[model samples]
Target chain A: MRYLVPLLLSTLVWWILTEAAQAWVVGVPVILVSTWVAVRLQDTDSGSAPTHRLNWFAVPRFALFFLWQSLQAGLDVAKRTLKPVPDINPGTLYYYTSIPHGTARYFFGAIVGLFPGTLCTEFSEDTDQLVLHVLDTDVDIALDCRRLEREIERLFKLPAADQQGRPA
Target chain B: MNLAFDIVLGLALLLTALGVFSSKDLFRAVVMFIAFGLLLALVWVRLDAPDLALAEAAIGAGLTGVLMIDAVAHLSANTLQNDQRDDQYDHSPKRPLWLPVISCVGLFVLLLGAIRFRPEASVSLPDMVRDNIAESGVEHPITAVLLNFRSYDTLLEIAVLLVAVVVAMALKPAAEDRVHQPPPAHDPILHGLTARLLPAMLLVGMYVLWAGSYMPGGAFQGGAILAAALVFLQLAGFAVDRYAASLLRLGLALGFLVFLTVAVSVMIGGRPFLTYPEGFAGQLIFFIEAMLTLSIGLILFSLFSQNPPHSGAVGHQGANHDQ
Candidate 1:
């Protein structure tokens, strides 16, 4: 039912947005059949589907944080670019992941990559480490790692680890 | 206010382009290039091409950004020395200044001559569709052109999209399988904002899509917006796996199927191929546009995701420090 609502909502929104009213009789059936086909395809490929746990109340705060961070990062990049000579020292660094779940880990990698000067190269399962290449190795690498770790951890509600493991 | 805004936007565009061209870091260059697309969309809007503006925002800025980033990601994984070599290459080459100056002068002369020699007027195409506009069904001229006048072009374009997808699939590396790792759970504040913004964005996107028939938007713009909103949701830690793939496939096929079905139905109804009966054109046009939007959005997102085969559910891990 939870999934059904979003699906219906998206379908309806898609229908209306496309102004499919004239062809609604035809379009509705198309959308439904296609949507169903899509669902079956997902089931076959990924095996498990994501369940939406609606926490409607928490949305606005996250958006504000994202906006603020994006703005800050944008400014930082602009400043670095305007310098007389680019002060960048490129290097690759490996960081370990604390997020256990696959979904959480992917989200973290994407968010960190969103920032300027960082590109995540690979995630290794054998050693449980993430490889990131950075343009400015002179910048505080550990600090950036901690910032990303905290942000992602907070977003996913993952278990906290100290230098060892403990609740923060 | 407008002037100030324009100045800022212009500067942003210049900076973005300069960043794209001048940056020694390839990844940074890719990111800047994406930013340049966004800035270019703004420029399009300022130039009073809202249709182009919307398309630029969705396909140009959004989709292209995804593709470039994916390409960069792929490149980074395979080579370390290549980056160093590229840096060296940037400094080693310069096409002589006089060559670019001569080319620019030559282009200017050709454009001026072409403009000067152009005919003052030209005959418009036969208005066979004017008396039949109401009967032809679609109201918008461009839509009419697309579905009724030049449907073969539209069909071929869809074929092109399919071909591009297949080509990309074939070219993608076999070992590059990985899913984006979820961000660590962030503060409640961040999550709250994302949730609030998503529905509103979706709402606006729908409005753009629906309003396209009468106003500046249609499916392509609307669908791109919708896709972007979904991408944002994905980034925000919204667990949204249920219909992503299937929805994508359906979206891709929707336009081609509907257009074909309707064209065939018309034939069954005793009209020529691609002919719409009286009062059915607008609806049919709407149908095609909607499907096209979905297809475009899906194709673009898939292009951006650029997932390689056989990587098999690898989670997006953190930045790997080791090159």
Candidate 2:
């Protein structure tokens, strides 16, 4: 019964799409046969977690935040480029994150990489620490990193201790 | 008035280019690059090349975005630590601002001169395509060119897709390490909505495929839509099968078989090569495209799978079907 829906749906789609060929009278049966053969040959069981439970409402918020940050980062880089002295103070720093799941961790790392001078170099799954490289090493830069960390924590709903960890 | 719009578009393109070059974040840079590709596609449309615009949107923006995102994911997984030297070097000696300024000026001047001093065409090829449009077997000029005038290029492009699949299969690690964690739980209403919409989405995909001959649909778009459906199923935890090796092989090879067989039979009919028999062109093309759609869908689904087929991993159990 579980397989029946998908099979019927696939067959219906295959028939409609091939209807224009004017050969559908013959083509539909061929496709159905092939589909059945394909299904039979497939491994009906593989142990991977299903991703059915997506947080739908958070998606738009995530997208908007990413867009705003991307724009801000773009402008920041442009300004640095236009400046005479370049004003670069580069340094690599280590920071810990409280995001437990791998997906959230990866998303956090990716979002951090969008800032003007920051690059997420490595994420240690065991320690939940991320190594980041920043072009500007000033005090303002540290504050900005903390701001980003807080934002990430807020978005992912991390614990307070992980959010307040020492900036390495 | 129209000139102002064109100027604005050009400036936007330039700004995007600058952003892509200057952005420190690699992922953002890639996203900007995709935006740049989209803008370029618009520029192509403005230049009266709708075909090029479509191709750029699909191949340039869509496919390239997928490839870049995959690359970024792989790079993030591999790099253990951020190098400190990158920051130290930023504080060192800086290049003169005049260098970039001079280069930009030089490039602009060269472009202006080239456009102003454009050469005149010497001769014109006979409009064989326009003249034979009625007899070309396809209603659309672009279709005629693709499947008739330059069929070989299209064939070779399909071959390239095959090679990509083969290469991915060859390089994939033998061990199936499933790293994709389950998505966070969502509202029951949203889940129910997704369930209801799945069937409708499949219908739309089919309609697009069927409409390709006369309209703006084709194997690629149809295939992508089908792949998305499959991806959705996988995400929804439906028909969780991970060891469908035989099915995978058949899906991957279906298009290649149909294309080859048709091409060879043309030779048997004493045609030069890949020439469809009169009154049969539409049928043959449709057959080939249908097969191609399946192949493309299967290949894309496989590429997006976290675990390779035959990895001996127990597939996820859920309400949806597996690809």
Candidate 3:
């Protein structure tokens, strides 16, 4: 029963790829065998703490915001490049984040990657400090990182980074 | 309008290629080479070869760039900046360069001759393919040519890829640099993103594979996309188990196995080897592609595992998610 979801999904994938209903004679068996193989191939630890517990509602909202931000950033960067006297001051700085270590941190990095002014060069393992290279030092990039951090927290339902382990 | 676009893209491609080879720094060369690949993909697109373009952008520009960058990172760690100083000081006698230069020139002239003569004889090939493409089990000319008209080439290609993977696996997996600290397991945002993205990536990968019968994608493109997604998951810190590694090896070999089995099985039915029974060619090819897509995806992703399959490579949440 635990394997049902992946099985169904893999079957759907197989059907989409094969696309011959009449060929079910061979397709069904092949699909089943392959799906069984896939199930066996997955890491056993995958199901222990699946990421689906996140608040689903914030995802689309975040995606829309991110896409718009990306467009704006791309245009801004393009403008900076083509201008005769480019008003840009590039510098690297550290952003201390509260996003949890595992996927959340990775997600945050990915998000930061798309933003206009900042590119994340590295994240410290010892501390939650993200090294960011920014196009403009004048911009309140720290505040912006914090704002994104808050949105991620809302989306992931994480406790505040500073307030971790605090009881409700 | 389009002419200007073509001229610019062509210039960019040439310049980027020149930059890649001429750059003294290995890192700079790798980056420039990736740029060249991307520009080449654009040229493929301008030439109306979308299938080739897709493969170029995905495998050529994308995966190749990642692979080269990985190689550069490892190489740079112990790299000597001696090349710069050596270039300025020790000038060895420039002998033995003429033979290689002459051979390269001869090869170039030979290619130019081929291009000059191609138009006279090449026109019939497409017409000939189009005339009998219906019986070839696919709507797209490239797919038909790949799977039916010239299946031996495809079979041999799959065998070669299998050999490459086996050879790579024989190498000791690179020691991971991220042995510092294990990230906490309950990263809610990462989990959420993975859960959302994985399904979509799988869907797109399968869609590309399915659409290949009539469209601009096939096993290779779909397989690359799926492999990238799987690698992304691993890089995000999913602990793949040992049993899963063996299971994946089976999956990795599945494509060649199925291709060979079908090829041999068809011979038992009195047809030539790899020539599917007339009525069942489409089904058989579709089946083979489904298997090929899975096998290719897993094999390509496994190439990036940097760990022995028996141990099941662990994905540590490194500083960079894109890694």
Question: What lDDT does each candidate get?
Answer: 0.62, 0.64, 0.72
- Report model 2's interface C-alpha RMSD after superposition on the true interface residues: 11.0
Q: What DockQ class does candidate 3 belong to?
A: incorrect
Candidate 2 local lDDT, A1-168, one digit each (tens): 534644676666666656555645544554455455334422221122121222445557767877887898898888877899886778987776655544445555766778767888876646867898887766455566666655555565554444564667
Off by over 4 Å in 3: A1-53, A58-83, A90-134, A139-168, B80-93, B117-119, B170-196, B233-245, B302-323
DockQ ranking from best to worst? 3, 1, 2
Kindly give the number of clashing pairs for every candidate: 62, 8, 2
Individual DockQ of the candidates?
0.08, 0.05, 0.17
Off by over 4 Å in 1: A1-168, B1-19, B81-101, B123-145, B148-150, B174-207, B226-251, B268-270, B307-323
* Per-residue lDDT of A14 in model 1: 60
Docking class of 1: incorrect
Best by TM-score: 3
* Candidate 1 local Cα displacement, residue B29, angstroms: 3.5
Residue B93 displacement in candidate 2 (angstroms): 11
**Candidate 1 residues A125-147, lDDT tens each?**
35557788887777766566666
State TM-scores per candidate. Answer: 0.57, 0.56, 0.73
TM-score of chain B of 1: 0.71
